[model samples]
Target chain A: MRRAVGALLRKDLTAELRTFESIPAMTLFAVTTFVLFHFGLDRSSLEGDLAAGVLWVTLLFAAVLGQNRLFVAEEEQGGFDGFLLAPVDRTALFVAKALALFAFLVVVEIVAVPAFGLLLLGPDLLDPLPGLVLVLLLADAGIAIVGTLVAGLAIRTRARDLIAPLLTLPLLVPVVLAASEATAPLLAQAGAEGPPGRWLAILAIYDLTIGLVAYGVFDFLLED
Target chain B: MQAPAILVRDLHKSYPSIEAVRGIDFEVARGEVFGLLGPNGAGKTTTVEILEGYRERTAGIVSVLGHDPGQRPRTLRERVGIVLQGGGVYRHVTVRELLDHWAHLYPAPRDVDEVIELAGLGGKQHERTRSLSGGQRRRLDFALALVGDPELIFLDEPTTGFDPAARRAAWQTVRTLAELGKTVLLTTHYLDEAQALCDRVAIMKDGRILTIGAPAELGVGALYRVVWRDAETGEVQSRETEDPTGLLHQLTSAALARGEPLRDITVARPSLEDVYLDLTEEPSAAASQEVRDG
Candidate 1:
């Protein structure tokens, strides 16, 4: 099972690297959306709840672009059938795909977060760097899990493009909520502050619970 | 004694509005090449998919290598390889990279280089899949299936659209699998393909097997077509008869005595293609006859 997961993950990352399919598009979307937020509110800088809301919302929608293309090569090229033919555990596919999406999210954040800092963030980006990274990582995990599951489900339908984001946005509302709440303090203009521990706990629990649910149901989606 | 490679009895499968497979029965012996010959919508794919454990059967029994495929156990998957018709390969990866990746999925896979050679993909290994021609991609599909070193392989419509040379090449690949002592189950609509590759074939239509037999045996009673031109009016005449030799002898003897030889004379036996057409075209009669034979 581990070998299968490793092979699958490596293939996804290799394809992404060769084609630059998911990450570049996702990163570009994030940066472009940030610029839009800057002008849409006509605000020179954002802080606290407003800043946190803008960042997570833009990231969540950008992640949707990643989710939409997640299973396309597999679906178009019969990758799912190839994977299903193997003797390994099916859950390994769920793990590999979720992790691949997680990696893409992290890479996008690596660039997008800094762009956010330079463009519209009022706080000294270095002051809240540590806590903000934690919040971003946790939120990315939640998005990755739910996004993988929804991507699997939506790919089976003809309306996958229209359906993936429709399904993903609602399911990811909790992650967005928890992540924004956690980052609000760190981005506060008054000074850097540690995020309340409860939001982190909520993000962790959400990841675990949904991760279990996605893992359990993913095998069925692979069939037919 | 060891059981057959595949044993399916009274199998039935239906979708919401259609009965895709209605109680079909057949068995393929170990190391044998079996084909399900049918036209489009003849339920060939549905049956093969059911055997591969991709879809569930609506009724009856199915056993592949002495195991129920519906359960899709890991051991069964480890032993069975499948080449789904037009199943996609990752276009971004090179041929060697893709094959190496698939090889790891199996416990004891064939060497990737050997598999590439076996599938006739030796020189193109370094090229990305998207760069390969259509025929090359199909060869890649075969390579992926063979990478597992499986005991039984399922090929659903392996060569539906191919030029004459490509089709023959595909046939050679199937022959290679048979030489390796692997049991193969393939579905194809090409009559010549079935005759050239399959040891035995089951003709199917409208969710049922029309008839199953060795290619030569199925045409045993089918007629031969004899055509010739008449000396008197220079017109062409043809006849379908059970005995082409007797018919030819009579015509030639009369023509020799009359001092004019027959023109455009040709006698052709009914091949497997003829048998397939006869069975598939007249479904109602054939189905009842099969039921009575049972």
Candidate 2:
């Protein structure tokens, strides 16, 4: 299982590097979302405590672009049949794919955050960015787990584009709420401190619970 | 006591309106190419998927490699390799990456390079799978299916779109697997492929096996067709008879007696396709059709 997970993770990461498939679109989405947030809410009267909520919401949606393409990485040429033929545990297949998407979302957010900081929010608006990064990572992992499964199902359907996001977003709301709560303090202040760790714990539990659910249910979805 | 590699008893599956496989029964030995020959929409794919542990059966018991496929699929699948109808190589990843990825999934896998060589993808190992031709990608699919060195392999229409040269190469690949003594369950619409590769074949229609046998032994004993030129009419005539040798002797002796040669003589026997059609042709006598006239 370890070997299978490593190989699959490497395969997907390498494929993402080869294509640069999701990052550009995700980056553009994050940047424009940031700019729109700043323009609409930067004023003294309109600047609100919902900056973190908006940011998490933006990042969560951007992940849909990344996650929906997960199975496509293995689907384009002839990979689906190969995957079915492999001897690995099916649950490992689900986990490794989710991890790969989580990693990609992290990479895009790493760049997008700084770019968003410079271009939209004043450069110093989000201080101690590491905590927010943690929130984003956790939330993104949740999104990827559910999104990856839905993407797997949707890719097999005739109406994939319409169905993937529909299947993904409903599961995404909990992650978005938890992550926004975790980041709200910092997003609303020059530098604020609260028990963001509690929110992180909630995010972790959701990830563990939802990850297992998706893993256990993958076989049902994978079958004809 | 040894057991069959695959045992499917009274299996059944249905879509919204049709039962694709209705109470089918069969067993495959450990080292034979078992052919499931049927026309399009005859439920071959559904039955193969059920046997591979990739689809749920509506009824019946199915055991592949000693585990019930529908109940404990992973236990069965780890030892089974499958090339589903069109599920082949992934396009975005390089060939090396895809093979290496699938290779790692097996409990114990063959060398990745050896697999690439086996699949004939040595030169294109670094190319993106999408960049390879249809045939190359198919070779990659075969490589992945072969990676785990599975005890049983399920190939569903493995060479559907291949050109002649590619098809022959794939046949060679199948021959290699048989040489390795691997049990392969093959489903195909192409009778020639069934004739060339399978040791035994089961002809099916409307979700039932019509007959099963060694290809050559399938039909009623071969009938010989005799053709000859008729003297005054100048038109050739043909006839089928069970005793061609005796008929030929009698005809020639009569011709000799009449002082005329038996010209344009021809003799032929039934081939597998003839037997296949005979075995698989539906007897509408058993079928009740809903007829409408305008």
Best by DockQ: 1
Off by over 4 Å in 2: A42-51, A74-85, A122-127, A149-178, A187-201, A205-224, B8-16, B19-25, B41-43, B57-61, B229-236, B255-264, B282-294
Window of ten residues with lowest summed lDDT in model 2 chain B: B285-294
Q: For model 1, how does the per-residue alpha-carbon lDDT over A1-224 read when each residue is reduced to its tens digit?
A: 88888988999999999999889999999999999989998998999999999999999988999999999988998888788888888888888999999999999999999999988999889989999989988999999999999999999799999999999999999999999999999999999899989999999999999998998889888774
Residue B75, candidate 1: C-alpha displacement in angstroms: 1.9
Q: After superposition, how far is residue B136 of candidate 1 from its true place, in Å?
A: 0.9
Q: Which regions of candidate 1 deviate over 4 angstroms?
A: B14-22, B221-230, B233-252, B262-269, B283-294
lDDT of 2 by residue, A46-100 (tens): 1124666666778877888887777874565445655665555666778788888
DockQ of 1: 0.67
RMSD of 2: 4.3
Tell me the docking grade of candidate 1. medium
Native-to-model Cα distance after best TM-score fit, residue B101 in candidate 1, in Å: 2.4
lDDT of each: 0.91, 0.78
- TM-score leader: 1
Error of 1 at B241 (Å): 6.6
